[model samples]
Target: MQANIGTIDRALRVVAGILLIALSLFGVIGLWGWIGVVPLATGLFSFCPAYRLLGLSTCKRCQ
Candidate 1:
């Protein structure tokens, strides 16, 4: 699939995901922290299913 997520967006997602997972590992949250993988994977791939379904794109001209 074409990339709809930009570098900044992906970076944010990765940061958010890492934070969520870290919180879980540190006992700051429960199993919900595992959900962090969603953002992590999407960030790494620079594509999001929800974005695709909604026809959204965050990629700039650089992409």
Candidate 2:
């Protein structure tokens, strides 16, 4: 599969994921906060199935 995510987007995902996980861990937020796992996974993997299905790409160099 092609890489469709941009560097800045990936970086934001990673940062948001970390924040969500941290808040969830602290019990200040609900379990739903753990949903950050999605961004975390996608950020690490550098691929988003939804983006692929929707024909959306944020890559700087798409071909």
Candidate 3:
């Protein structure tokens, strides 16, 4: 799929995802934090299914 996530967005997602996962692993948050995997995967892949569904894209290059 084409990359619909921008550099900044991707970076933020990765950071947030990592933070959530870390918190979960450290028992600082509930297992729900494991959901961070979604953002992590999307960020790494630079593709967001929701964005695609909504016909939105944060990457200017894609426009």
- Report, for every candidate in turn, its global Cα lDDT versus the true structure: 0.91, 0.88, 0.96
> Candidate 3 clash total?
0
Scored by lDDT, model 2 comes in at 0.88
In model 1, which regions exceed 4 Å deviation? none
> What residue runs in model 2 are displaced by over 4 Å at the alpha carbon?
none
Model 2 per-residue lDDT tens digits across residues 5-58: 889989998999989998999998979889999999888888889999999888
lDDT of 1 by residue, 5-41 (tens): 9989999999999999999999999889989999999
Error of 1 at 32 (Å): 0.6
TM-score of each: 0.91, 0.91, 0.97
Show the lowest summed lDDT stretch of 10 residues, model 2: 54-63
Model 2: what TM-score? 0.91
Give the count of colliding residue pairs in each prediction: 0, 0, 0
Query: Can you tell me which runs of candidate 3 are displaced by over 4 Å?
Result: none
Q: How displaced is residue 19 in candidate 1, in Å?
A: 0.6
